[model samples]
Target: MSMRVLKSTGAAFVMQNMRTCVNKPIYKETFDVNSLKKICDMLVVSAQQRKLVRLAICPQVTQHQIWTGALMEILNQLEIEMCVKDCMKGSNMAQQIVVNCLRFLDDVVSYDPDSTSWMRVAPKKDADSSPSAKWSDLLEMFNDLINCLKNDHEFLFYVIKLEIMKEGLSQIKDVLVDKNIGYKEALHQQSLVHKKLTKSLGHSSRCLFTLLLYYLYGSIQDIELDICWYSEDVSGNKLYLCVGKIIASDEDKMLMHIFKQLDRALGVIKFVHEMAEMKEILEIQGHLWCIGSKNRSFAYRGHNFFIHGISLE
Candidate 1:
């Protein structure tokens, strides 16, 4: 079929199928990966032609010709299976599939939040040219792309990591470990409680950092080359504070394990502290670890103090 004919017919078919699915439960399941791929493929082609698929897909709409939420769920599942599990990482068409799926997601999610779902049925216009014209939903789409693309290349991972940090930090800064949580007890308490509290509040940065930490900490055997890429924003501060806390608290095994995984990236932490002008704070924290190393002497205000020293001064 000519691309134009396919785009028109495919969009019409999707609308009709979506309408039928509203009344029939079986039709809901019918919009599986293959069905979604067909729709997404047509949307991708249409996008190339500067014609986006604009159908009402939100909850309040009466016609209910599309279910964007369900569509996103399917995409999430396929993403996990294909990208996360690396099942289709080697497939020739996997990248295209991912690109189309994400493009369609951006399309549906790009609907003006202020507009009613019914308004989505309007004819396509200049607003549909870019997949991310409406940036309110940008991260929701970018996150999936990041997860899908990160494992593919270090430079790509670095790029997406920076973007995520910018967006995630701006929108969900509270879920971030407080930069002041530099003390061991504070860090420990925060780690134990932040996950549950953040989940209850419907935030994501906590989970994102927790998972990233898990990956970094667990990579004791084969750390990636771009491990240093995480040394900025949410990841960098959280980790720096985390390491300082762990070291201060005498988490000997964990400290050693994390250090091993971090390898040479430890320098990045130093650089990060320098950039933040928190070098003095890092030096002070370093003393917590040095307490066990050896005796040290320092003179302060005409008084001499030594490591493990007891003095009235």
Candidate 2:
């Protein structure tokens, strides 16, 4: 097919055809570096346009020496430096291309050749041998790409921020919250923060709150919830507060002040409601300490709890 035809056909169709072609020995023999480069160029453009393209090059493809050599050559010619420069200039398209390329290389290098189905054909003894030359080359190429990307300070900052946002999002579901309501609420908040971070480098108040939660109380299993009614404020408003304390670690001591600020910024009622939802969901027992005023009315997991002046010391 002509290059124009391939481009118009889109990544999904081309990727499927490439996968099928790889299975044929003649296709492998005839595939040259220029052809592979063209295919990759198409993929980069598609990905830049935010289209998903299942990677054609993977561990299974690398099993063939010819394909591996072609991949190495294409990787060598990758315009990673130019792409990163564009990324530093605030080009989201360039950023997407760079991230996709890095992730693609990461997938290739992290794959275990032994896990491939073709490995079953080889004897166990042969499969257990040291890493093959192709694997070594892929690893070297991945490292080179990383080194190149890291050379640009601004690009490296952007990459680190993206990774932090990813980690924060992944852990949001694991947060100890009510399955019915708190889960959705927490997810929405986290998603908003992620969206803001993606468009700009600035951190919003919600971003600070998110980073604090994930950084300090990320593991719900080891967290302790302390809820209490402090003295009435000057305006005669009763203060009900909930504080998250790390039960098993001393790391909280150093950042205790910062955590307090972040928690307080969310206000007492909202904070207590959030913590109560989590406490009920996780069925956390014995770690909860309630103090101060009796006859304080508060809401916990959609239930009204009227507690007399009782302290759980």
Candidate 3:
């Protein structure tokens, strides 16, 4: 069938079949690898046409059938050199294919069939025939691609760096350490691969570093804004000062407000200090308020006061 027609009909067919099997188990014995491969090939054609096609297949089918056969076919076509060559010339078809392949692989590996009752694990025939073994093989392929990207195709590597980190590093980690598979050795090996990948990428690009920090800390906050506060009692007898730092993930408008508050606070402090020196007073009587308008306020000794603060950017 022509790919144009296939793209339209293939997804409908798969969705229809999937809907019918909603409450039923999809056995590995009855899984159709050839059909899955044909669908994957059509996805490639869709990418070549610069069209977006969403193909929804059973995750069980993807995990079991595609990993063993169809996935290799997709991966083989994801050539880094092709992507780089096309990208340099202002074409994105090759890069699109790579993206589609990554999306397919993501769908295959990201699904957690162990938590569902509709997908049963196929019986293992030997040590090398289990699902964990398949995952190990998949990890090996990812490591090979990553190494190639790091060593030779630096440009293409940065282009798809986030997707690789999300799928290869994040999702694959979940698969390797799945309680059902329990592949500790495989997980350890994957960790080593990640360490090498990160070390190599960390030197040249901040993309991987940002992603790694997000994965490690659950958020990326690289911009540290130091803040200081100065306050005095109503009697102006005692001075209180607090200093700290804020780690911001992005420079949003809220940060601008913080900056303004810091500037205002610094001005107030300077004015108060100069006046205190001019009068030869031991301390200033009025508050050196440097707090943002929206910030928290506290009441002390029947007087409400704002915290004096400034950012050391």
User: What lDDT would each prediction earn against the true structure?
Assistant: 0.32, 0.31, 0.35
Positional deviation of residue 175's Cα in model 2 after best superposition, in angstroms = 22
Local accuracy of candidate 2 as per-residue lDDT tens digits, 34-102: 122222231222332221111212212212222223333333334454553554443454444445544
Report lDDT (Cα) of residue 184, candidate 2. Answer: 43
lDDT of 3 by residue, 144-251 (tens): 544444443444534344333334343334334333433344345445444433333321233333332333223322322232223445565544433222322213
The true-structure Cα RMSD of candidate 2 reads 28.7
Structural similarity to truth (TM-score) of each candidate? 0.20, 0.19, 0.25
Question: How many clashes in each structure?
Answer: 0, 2, 1
> In terms of TM-score, how similar is model 2 to the real structure?
0.19
Residue 167, model 2: Cα distance from true site in angstroms: 8.8
Best by lDDT: 3
> If ranked by lDDT, best first, what sequence of candidates would result?
3, 1, 2
The digit string of per-residue lDDT tens for model 1 on 161-259 reads: 435334322343333222222234333433433333223221123223222232323211222211011122333233212111112222457445434
> What's the CA error at residue 36 for candidate 3, in Å?
44
